[model samples]
Target: MRAIFPIVTVVIVAIIGVIVFHLLSFPMPWMLGSLFGVLLTQLIWKIPMKWPVMMRNIGLLIVGTAIGQLFTFNILIAMKDTLLFMFMLNIVLSLFCLAMAYLLKKWARIPFATAIIASIPGGLSQLVVFAEEQKDIDVTVVTFFHVIRVLFVVGLIPIIVSLTGEVPGAPAQGSSNLLHNLSLILLGLLLLPIGKKLRLPVPHFLTPVLIGLLLSLFKVDVDPMDGHLLHIAQLCIGAYIGLLLHPKSLRLPVRVLIGGISSAILLLVLTFFIAEGMVFFFDLDFATSYLSTAPGGMDQMGLIATALQADATHVTIFQLFRMLFIYVIILPILKWKILK
Candidate 1:
């Protein structure tokens, strides 16, 4: 009962943000609005707010389930041709991120391990876990960098994609059947433990995605959720992100903050050039290629892809491949080469 009030307060504030952004015709109004709303309220008023990890997990599950349904038989077949490209792209992108890590190391005067871990464009949770295991690495700096970068990427990418032009196909119209979605939600819940047991990098999100993809391959009829559900998911995620950026929570030197922000911007610029290269080399549009390669959170990019009606199937594959690459190949090499 005591904790519930704060939760309800933030939710109400987040809803107001959604309403305001929706009125302004903003792209990703629910997410952007709720995110900024909660962030500003906390920063300005210092309101007591609390969003549970479970809320965020629920949001990821919804997003993962939606993205999973995108993997149709034809789409999977088409993705085969790009699998090699995706692998190569991850290597190149990781290399560039490492280079930027060196720059961040010098600019911020932080240890190389801390800089590299912070600069690596991997999942925040996973990166933080990695940082926690290492000696002399500032987990706070790593968390701050990723959070700021994700905030920038999430806030900017959707607007840029919206400004570029309309997405080619029709927007996804989610199923209206309550029972079907409820069953899917139940299944996602059941898989949670399995995901944790497997120790997948991002178990909540990836587990549902894998399940959805398997269902797709087997020709199961799970309707992709519509805007209403997506809105709720966005609200859940956005509000939490807003709280993460609560100004008081971050206590770092001005130089480090500047380095973190500038490095994040630099990464976005670098990603844009790579995205352009993707456009030139492959028969892909800028939006799909950009979102696919952008070193942001997979869930956030997935959300933007769905909103833009870009090749979400392609985006999911590329993002997933990058994530796995980071965990399996890149992190191991870093641990052995750098930490050793």
Candidate 2:
């Protein structure tokens, strides 16, 4: 009977994965992977096993560092105008999300830690990586809300693009760039160990970007095209997201779901307007502006930009800026406020 549960759960999620892989692209595929794991845990393993902590970290490292491959000094030069506006907008949105988290924390009577963790704009696995220290982490609740957060943004991507007269995103030349890919693998392996040992603020998920930038500034060559190697890394990420689920975690109550939905609505509405305002500030098109600033998962947002055939490159650029900004800049500001 116990074995039956795990078996059925795996089968169902695998089928869901196939559908998601075919219909969805990039970051949406991450969500589909997450959803499958959530369902499997709910139906089968009611017993809690600790969230697969290492798998989660490795996945974050893989995807986050993979992101570094997308960068080049030329891109940085092009972003000068866009960067200033985005910096201000990300600050505003981060504050906005912080306020919403406080409100939800009060309504739910959950711990400040859980609220803050759930409130973080992107990187679910990274946030929850620290959640185990809680007296009662309520991993399910945190997981549920962040999951919905991505789904909300992803679900709205096609609709938003259509309204703005945008087409699906095209693949970028740099996405497969040899320099980016090589730098990523080396960056991933190098910084991950140091990140774990030093207990750094945001960990080494973005280590590639930081390191790559340093190397670029120093004019060092570290070119290697190996996204094919990234496939296993992606699956590792999927598995980490999957391991967070337990059989009972999916049985969320009505009030919690309602509150989460309300919070999500609050987040999306705020992100949209902020993104639009950023467009005016940067002289960008409507689609690029909105998506670039849409406060969500880095990869998922990029994928949405990719699918729409819009300025995904620009959108992705902003997302990267916002992520690095949040992880590096805002985190210190927040340290006293929460992270500490």
Candidate 3:
């Protein structure tokens, strides 16, 4: 009974979002609709909306499996061809983050640690957790900036893709056998625990994707999920993201809010330049390049790539590379230099 109102609110907002986006012919209507719908509702009413974590994990599972269907040999070959470029991009993005952090420290009057953590392009949750362990770092401000960055990227990238006329690909037609689809789904589910046990980032998404990729490599005939299932997955993910934007938690001065918004805009602009570079140098498509450079969560970017019929595998790989570079390399250096 206690959870009923929030659940109802989410459903109502999501329905409204779907209708609005559909009417407007928006790209990734279900996702963008639910995201903005709940976002607007939360902003206006200041409602306490909560979507269960398990529901989001379930959505990730579905989306991961769907993306995995694209892990064919040809895609793998293409990814290999671009491996060096991806590595360079990751390094360049890391430097861009550090430069932004310095600007924040200078202009925003943010403490060094907070600015550094907030400036980081990926690892929002991890950065927040790390900030909690540091002295004189405002976790609220860090979270505010991180949340705003993700919201800005997610909200805008799809619209840009739509404007560029990146049409959604034909819906996947997997094996017609129900049992086969069930088995693939179950396999993905079973891998979740292993991913968690291994302490992988975004285990719910990464585990299933890796499992699906392995199955694909072995020539296992996994069924692609229907379009309706994909929409449901998008709805779940969008609602979860919407619920994350707690305006009440952002107890900052107006100046600070302005600074945070500026930082987010700067990051978005840098992402756009990098993406364009990829297009010119690597000759990747607009959707793929934009998604690869977009500074949103890996799972969210992958979802957008899947929706836009971009190379999901390429997006996933690039995102994973950035995450790994940030967490494994940049984070340690930041800790040593700033925290110590």
Candidate 4:
């Protein structure tokens, strides 16, 4: 009976999503669905059943794969601008962290690497993986801080949208061109085992970047077109996040918590102004610049673009570029110089 409850919950949420689709004229209200799921899980059963976790993971894998497939060759042309933005964004984000880290180390008395890990944008899984790799840092501390950052970003974004007088595509639902989406998903899954065999450096979804670049070599494009699939994917990821809530686990000292929140929000606002200036200087669009500096994951930023119906291409370009910077430059530098 307990096992069945989560299954029942998912069915109910899906039904609600469908109903929302029709009533809202196709907007899925992801934030509402997510909050409802989280609140329901907490209230109905503060201790989540295995079924809920399983369902949530399925949603994560599916949505994450689909979102990853959106990468393509045009990213190359935009690479120059993105790289420049990375250099600039990196300096700002790092400095913001550096100052915050000093404060955290002084008051919180945590190590520099732990503080830096906490300051990282999204990429929680990678942070965990790296935490494991680092000999000295407390994985628990890094995880705690990263979790705080995610909560802050997710919470703040909706508020920002509300202030802008746009509800986002909250109840978004529409035809997602998913003809080849399954194939891409399958391919992403396939890469995991193969990568395990081949010892690839990153997660399976990352291979699509290499795959995209290689496909570009042959002038072959495979950016999947199913927007509906993307929505479902986002739903899954969002659900997984919702399941992660536990007010009990957030027992941080008030000073550190306040400092972390202040640093992130301050950096977010400052980066927004800087990004806007950079966009104007580079003749880029407003929506694109706004998203690129929006503080958090690439997929989340892209979702913002979709919800607002903004310039997705530019957002994707810079977000991906910035992420690549994190992967290749920032991660390695921090790992080598600081974490190591």
Which tens-of-lDDT digit does each residue in 75-105 have in candidate 3? 7776787778878877877787788788878
lDDT of all predictions: 0.83, 0.60, 0.82, 0.60
Model 4, 1-340: lDDT tens per residue? Answer: 9768865665556446445644664333664355445545654565543225445444444544544444456665656655766677766776777777787888787787787777766466667787888788877677767665666665565456446543424234344445565676666666666655765334443454445455557776455436666556556555555545456545767766676667667767876687668667876555556676766666566565655555554565566666666777877888778766
lDDT of the structure predicted as candidate 3: 0.82
Using lDDT as the measure, name the better of candidate 1 and candidate 2.
Answer: 1
Residue pairs in clash, model 1: 174-226
Against the hidden true structure, what lDDT does model 4 obtain? Answer: 0.60
Where is model 1 more than 4 Å wrong at Cα? 169-175
Q: After superposition, how far is residue 89 of candidate 3 from its true place, in Å?
A: 1.3
Clashes of 3: 0
User: Candidate 4: which stretches are off by over 4 Å?
Assistant: 1-28, 35-72, 158-162, 165-178, 192-204, 208-224, 311-313, 331-340
Write candidate 1's Cα lDDT for 148-180 as tens digits: 998898888778777878445666475567567
Better of 1 and 2 by TM-score: 1
Candidate 3 regions exceeding 4 Å error are 168-179
By summed lDDT, the worst window of 10 consecutive residues in model 2 runs over 47-56
Q: Using Cα atoms with residue i matched to residue i, what is each candidate's TM-score against the true structure?
A: 0.94, 0.64, 0.94, 0.75
3 or 4, greater by TM-score = 3
